[model samples]
Target: FADLKRDRHDDETINTVFRSVHSIKGGAGAFGHERLQHFSHHYETLLDLIRNGTLPLSEPLIDLIVAAFDTLADHVI
Candidate 1:
């Protein structure tokens, strides 16, 4: 998340973030944590858009991603 905050437009960071969230989503699904899996699915979708150049990186989008990370972290804990 810190890396994303620092470089929201960086492809490498975006891919890393996507993979992290994807892993979380997969684990959540495997563990039958439906809510976490759902949230991460949507979050991953957004990252996918960014990665595919369908969505432009903006301050608001970055903020949203950061906030989602917080939510996901809370779920993990």
Candidate 2:
């Protein structure tokens, strides 16, 4: 809900995702999961930029994030 379907409260959803990814990164690092940690670091960075308005949220960007998240899921699974 960071773009097309966004509402006034959508920021909460965005922030929640950022936090979740951040936690995953931290856990991965602690466990020595370098690949997971590295991917998550970049994913978290992208989310950070989007939430802070450093990067504009667009459909293409959303698709990119979704694909990256899928990769992250693969790393964990």
Top TM-score prediction, candidate number: 1
Residue-level lDDT of model 1, residues 1-77, one tens digit each, is 67667773468888988999999999999999999999999999999999999998887899998898889989897
For model 1, the local distance difference test gives: 0.90
lDDT of 2 by residue, 1-77 (tens): 44434433466667887998999999999999998899899999999998998998777877787687778778777
Q: Candidate 1: minimum summed lDDT over ten consecutive residues — where?
A: 1-10
**lDDT of model 1 at position 49:** 100
- Report the error of model 2 at residue 35, Å: 1.5
Those runs of model 1 whose alpha carbons end farther than 4 Å from true positions after fitting are 6-9
Taking the candidates one at a time, how many backbone clashes does each contain? 0, 0
True lDDT of residue 8, candidate 2:
38
lDDT of each: 0.90, 0.81
